[model samples]
Target: MYYKGVYHLFYQYNPKGAVWGNIVWGHSVSKDLINWKELQPALYPSKPFDKYGCWSGSATIVPGQGPVILYTGVVDKRSNEVQCIAIPANTSDPFLTKWVKPNRLNPIVTADHNMNGSVFRDPTTAWLGKDRLWRILVGSKHDDTGLAYLYRSKDFVKWTRAKHPIHSAKTTGMWECPDFYPVPLQGKNGLDASMIGDSVKHVLKNSLDMTRYEYYTVGTYIQNKDKYIPDNTSEDGWGGLRYDYGNFYASKSFFDPSKNRRIIWGWANESDTKEDDVKKGWAGIQADVEVTFSFSSLDKAEAFDPNWVNAEDLCAQKGSKVQGGLGPFGLLTLASKKLEEYTPVFFRVFKASNKHVILMCSDAKRLLSNN
Candidate 1:
């Protein structure tokens, strides 16, 4: 989130090693997004509420309060996830270095009797509604169904779960790092999470644990009814619109009031095996890339096969080398001089009955050598 003329980034980090473990909220700040200066770890397993681990969550700048973080805290050995709140010890400090978790309301929201505690986690950035209440969502699942549990609070401290989830879908499995926000219907400008009206459409994004990919839907948020109805423009579950067709998960977006636009980022897990990571001593890297593409026409785009339901499978079949009228066209990154070891990041266009479907592939199939 952008605050006090600086952009703060908090991520899941394992201070001890390259692989994931000993989770804590790693902190970094940047004047420009390109360069960052590391700060002391923001939140760790210091109190009983987060003793086991401190996991993913988001930050919201409250109206009166300077800034608050709502994160998933694993309280015990069973991996029971609960929503917890933390505030900057010194809000006046532009960097907002130290933090304090109030014991009175540390675990502000927990799984109800019918819900599974282990799978409940990742609170989104809270937003205040027109009705004078703060709202947030915690991701979870019931059996084969994914859920975004909604909670409303008059005061930021005390929260109550709604009778039903704001939204859910069967077979999507556990939804991690669920995000809810609003965007303008006509322009690139992003609406604040609290914004409501016909001029804006709300978005709900979920990271599917079963598939290890993130999917999102543009829908109408019926605030009075506390329900979300997705438009029929795309599928609601497995075969839905993805933020990225490649290795991306646990994405969170924040409205940058500075730029009047929303920014999103996600984690890309290591492509290599666990053994390879152990050998390398480092498992992953954080990166950001933006690309622009232009095509003369879509007249010769391949006819999208109806059987191509799974995008990853389709990308594997029609890779970057395969020719197409409009695509299989994009950049090759991390390449060798001979171009034998490069990762192809490209897009392919397929013609459907009424519209054109664009498929993006960041194929890392050749990242490693057999030997």
Candidate 2:
């Protein structure tokens, strides 16, 4: 959330190790998204409500309250996922470095004993309703049916379960990281999540744990009935429209009041092995874009070309290097006029367990002058 000209980002982190365990709320602040400064863990395992772990959640700026957080906490080692809240101890500090979770109001929301506690997690960022109440969605599943259990609260503390979910789907499995928000039909300005007006539509996005895909529906939000009905064109099942066809999941969207636009963020799973990730000391890709390259004749380079380039020498060089096992390669380079100094970029393909694997590299050692 953007507050006082600074952007605050809260994410799930493992304080004890580099891998996922002992989860806590990791906080960071930045004026621009490009550069960031880390603060101490904003929220962690505390009180009986969240003694196990402090998991995924979001931040919101309320009217009188500067910033409020609603997160999922594991109450016990059995993995009982319960919703909890944390408020800033000092709103005067723009970064919101300190947060206090009152013992009395610790577990703000919880599932019934009959429901599966393990599948109930990831509370959405709460939104104000037209009835002057706050509403939020918690993701869960009944067998293979995905569910977004809706809850309403006059005050952020006390919440009551709605008779029906805001939305649900069959055979979608667990729906995690459900997000609901409003967008104007014809303008760049974003509407508040609870905004009820004509000229506007609501969006409901959910991450499917079974498919590892994030799907969304854009349609009308009936505040009077407290239900979300998708448009005829919008499909709700696994084969429906997805936010991304690739490795994006667990996405959350929020209104950027400063820009008057809504922005979304997602986690992208990497296609590399776990050992490779551990060797690199990272698990996911920050930028989930696939870049392809080919050579040009004019300057022996095709700048930013998405299609495959035509480079005979590069292909020959690669084929010879690989002993005719793999073909159809290309060269990319930026060289000086005298050809004395050059930087060559290339890709090599190899057959790995009946699948073609690509190894991308820049031959700086072979191209650059030793001196």
Candidate 3:
């Protein structure tokens, strides 16, 4: 995916077989800022570090003696408490093609018996800077509420633990995927605009401005650098960051040190309308969007603003918007007929007996475009 000008995307795919057994990284590229083409797998379950499964992880290209990188914590079914780092095997396309080894440093971040499995998983690694060098946000269940762990890395290889989030009643739900960054606020004029992803169509459409936000899709993170305390951060009125309201979850934000700008992206959605991942042979999909953030002050209120750009803007198709019947929606029929095989349109649906269900795809997406 190309952001601003440079292209970037790391692959998250299962390698060994069709099952979620061994996950590895795949690579891709683009130039005109939107179009992208598939490349090969970048990181895979290799020797000491990733033998179990490469699992899910993000990429950080920090200024090192050369290029810097850190990803997730995945353990094979064979061994427990396994933590390792994989070096980029081929620097040509760093996003794809990686070689693994137990960190010469070994477990830059490790799990403790005190910590449980629900948390302590995938690490979204990014370079904040030299002093704030490497910042890793790992899924964690430190307090009763779900949270993430933060670690700082000065050198590309060595990492020091940093502040962990203190939860609060600011929002509901356990924190998992986490992202932190500044957004461009709209000029002091009208309702500050922020692009919000539509859960109904599973694509991001512009929505209201957000001063602070958090979610399960991007997990959760603390916005204020100060007032950050490590232990027992989950307290009432403790204050946390959420990106948007409604069903938008699992959002990840990044700051481009070079541009002095902040940007965010998220899982387009959490679930695929009751379709079984085990059966579709594919699990979750990254929302397929790259958001651009700009700050603004409106109504005399000061706030950080985020503007979202979606696939609808990139690989979006322009045709008569399809309208279907209105009710609940589902995928396959009890008779085992596939929907996508039939038409490229949205549906209006209703639940029926256990087997025979009817889906109408021609009359109701417009609540107000009614004729």
Candidate maximizing lDDT: 1
Residue-level lDDT of model 1, residues 1-371, one tens digit each, is 88989999999988887778998998999988888889988999988989999999999999877789999899899999888999999988888888989998888988888789999999999988889989999999999999999999998989999999999999899999999999888978877888999898889999999999999999999999789999987789998989988778888898888888898988877678877887788876668778888777789998988867677778888877778878888888889986768887889888999999988888776554452
TM-score of each: 0.91, 0.77, 0.54
Instruction: Candidate 3: list runs displaced more than 4 Å.
Output: 1-6, 15-21, 76-83, 90-103, 127-133, 163-174, 184-249, 255-263, 269-371
TM-score of predicted structure 2: 0.77
Give the winner by lDDT: 1 or 2. Answer: 1
Write model 2 residue lDDT over 93-167, tens digit each, in one string: 878889999888978998987789888888887888767898888999998999899888988899999888877
Better of 1 and 3 by TM-score: 1
| Model 1 TM-score, 2 decimals | 0.91
Instruction: Give per-residue CA lDDT, model 3, range 85-161, as digits (tens).
Output: 65656555534335545456655666655666434555664536324555555655444454555666666566555
RMSD values for the candidates in order, in angstroms, are: 2.9, 9.9, 13.1
Candidate 3 has an lDDT of: 0.42
- The ten-residue window of minimal lDDT in model 1 covers 362-371
Task: Go through the candidates in order and give each one's C-alpha lDDT.
Answer: 0.88, 0.76, 0.42
On the 0 to 100 scale, the lDDT of residue 362 in model 1 is 80
